[model samples]
Target: MKDLTSAVEHRQEHRFARSRDPRSAAKILVYHPEPEDYVVGIRRALPDAEVVFGSDPDFLRQHIGDTEIILAPRFPVEALQDAQRLKWIQSTNSGVDFLVPVRERLKNTLVTNARGVHGEVMADYVLGTVTMLHWDFPDLLRQQAAQQWKPKFVDPLSGKTIGIVGLGAIGAEIARRAKSAGMTVLGMRRGSARLGEPVDQYYTREEFDEFLSRSDFVVLVVPATTETYKLVGAKELSAMKRSGYLINISRGSVVDELALIRAIGDGQIAGAALDVFEVEPLPPTNPLWTMPNVIVTSHIAGNPTEYPRRILEIFFENARRYLAGEDLINVVNLARGY
Candidate 1:
């Protein structure tokens, strides 16, 4: 990986060195290729902006010098410094971990995320999964597979308590949907400050255990950050009700894999619905796959059929805000890592 990165960087350096005109709006730098509708939406949003698409390190280094802003699916961390004119970065991913490399270097550049764009889609996923579990859909499937027609009692989502670990756009969306389902929504944020939303109450990190103890379902939507690393572990998992379920849509590392495995094995929580994992592709040897109570997905929570177009909408909205000298929406707080 190191050798491949070095090679890419070397190519980028050559692109930067060979380019004669470092300033051209027609070549506004974009990192990915063939995002037809996304590109169109961006163009429509910034009519005068020029768009350039390249993933090659060399091409990026050379062409980024004159780029005013980057509408990237993935930020070119190593090549960001090459773009002397870069004023802002619109990331396709909600998490801003990719920006860690340039956050300090590009102090003057604004960083925004596709926070709200993917919220509804992800919320739908969570809502659907929660409903299936509540209605004993899994057991029904099992009975059908076994050639038996056993009936089971089920409960409604109404009056159940849902704990939202993060209150960002996605979390807020989940909270709204869960509440509308008649579940009492309890939010656990880093602070106690109230956000304009439908949360019944909010708790701080200090109250995480207390919050977990009372929830029927605990959903994690926090970002990946040093502070959030292993936020949910043995002790936290132990606090949950034995009849409750845990749902994770956030980065995988937020929950400790070993602890989670133990929790489920010991029936600490009823089940789990995991989108992300500590390791990608969830290595063949991982036990979580075979765990009867755990439902695993290959990190598809935020991926929607219209993902690219929705992201472009946010880009256009932010572009309008940026040019108008207004506060951009979904701006990331580097200190908090959201």
Candidate 2:
């Protein structure tokens, strides 16, 4: 596989070479709620730039025409037509699905994301979830709710194998932690044959079935895209070991919700720990919510106490680069939809 670090650096350099002169007084918009210090930091970094903050759609729409840059988790695709001077968007979230709808309008604009910032927190969530499922923590919780005591034998993670579907920033971190816990790590990447310390074996998409068959825990970390939409469905789930667990910290669309519910109900796979879903807030009526073996968390795997601070660091660094006419980091490849 191409060294992700080098690939990103090369892309940044290429984009910087084509970049125009830095605007002396660009209008910036922060469409998400942020700490006061974050706004101060941006102002400090771009002294001459005009910065505005608002969470309302109307407010953002009114300012889109003059805004040159936007730092937000989500933006109204319909407002792109009014953003005459918009040149760049820095997404606070790692995934850029919010911008996918307006991709054509963004053809001339640069987009960057908070990719590296999420690795640690997300890894922690993956590790915790995997262990909880493996040790039957949900059953224990149920017993507690009944005011009864029960003990059950549990499998150890040390001797088991973990398959990480996406070997990106978050996936790599999960591999590292899983390896440290004594699990053999099997990783799948789109390209590159290089094997690393944490990963015992690397499988390309062609070997996905083999990867699934060997994993005791399958972790999904890939971004949501046309190619990834419902990437894991009935066939893939059926290929997994009956005792294996699935963990998804990626977008909900990556897994077919109906197939997953059926798989769990039919005992095709052991269980799943889901942090994201095809729908947010995961409606109370959803079967996954009521499934005994399933563990669900509201799309908060990457949210940590220091998330704002960490993301702000990325934004500030990129803002400085923007003002200094240097290459910005974590630049997104709009065509790849990451």
Candidate 3:
């Protein structure tokens, strides 16, 4: 496979390998909860490869030993223990942070993710939430439910500042949409060096508090990693404007759940729209469910109706490149946990 490299500041030089052709000795494991949905496409993509599809753990253990490639949104990390012929693993999900813990086990395998596909849908979701907050739609719905006709004025989004916590692919999409709305886009990432993106201002790692204080609506689009786990807590929350709103499309662990509840309860910040949570299905006893200012959505922000179509596209294209002994796209840098 091709070796592509050019330093992009904080980003890593992605490495790919010349893989064994499926027609030869390569064996592939196509794993999914519903394997029937993908079998045809997977087979069509790798016509000469030996492919096995299943979701059962026993089935996985039975076939994973000599598999050269495994494709799925998720699978048991433990199943990779004896995957000696595993040359690569294609993840249907964009974030590969979950594999950080078992980095040592995957030392020889190349990991690629569905990174480019989620940008449009996720950006649409984030922009939808932002407009809801800016126009006070939550309160308007409450009044409509109460049969009250109280009309109110709202500030326009044109002159507002939107701070993006992580400026990756999805974050770039969000920034583009926010900029189109005439809002000033402020972005913060670990890298201080600017690559000339669309953002109006770039905030360094040390300027987090000041960045938080200036935004009208803050969006969290970071991945889940040790450095980002509980990245937002009471102190971070307290730094924001009391009237500022928060939109988190990232993992729930990125924000401290307990601290978030207290911050909203105490009116430290205005409110939040959360798509991911620490506990899924968010227990009936959790206070976030009843908070009039909060919006709790199940983790459905990324994998919408067209998810399978886009993710499979990435998988097939990369499969062609891998089989042709060319560069594979979206190869992840495990050390950085993207």
Model 3: lDDT to the true structure: 0.82
Candidate 1 residue-wise lDDT, 178-204, digit = tens: 988989999987655555688988898
Clash pairs, candidate 1, are 11-58, 12-57, 12-58, 15-62, 16-62
For residue 173, model 2's alpha carbon misses the true position, in angstroms, by 0.5
Worst 10 residues of 1 by lDDT: 1-10
Q: Write the per-residue lDDT of candidate 2 for residues 1-338, one digit (tens) a residue.
A: 11111112223423322222333456788888653665776777666677898888898899999777888888778889988767678898999987876788887678999989889999999999988998878988888899997767766789899999998888999999999999999999777745564899998887889999999999999988888999899999999999999999999999999999999999999999999999898998999988999999999999878777788888877766664556788888877888
Q: Give candidate 3 misplaced runs (Cα > 4 Å).
A: 1-25, 192-196
Off by more than 4 A, model 2: 1-24, 33-37, 193-197
lDDT of 3 by residue, 1-338 (tens): 22211111212243334343323645678788876656777667656667799889898888988787888877888888877667778988888877888988887778999998888888898899888877777889989899999868877899899999999888888999999999999999877535656799889768899999999999999989998999899999999999998899999899999999999999998899999889888899999999878877888778667567777888878766764556778988788887
For each candidate, C-alpha RMSD in Å?
7.5, 5.2, 4.5
Order of candidates by lDDT, top first?
2, 3, 1
Candidate with top lDDT is 2
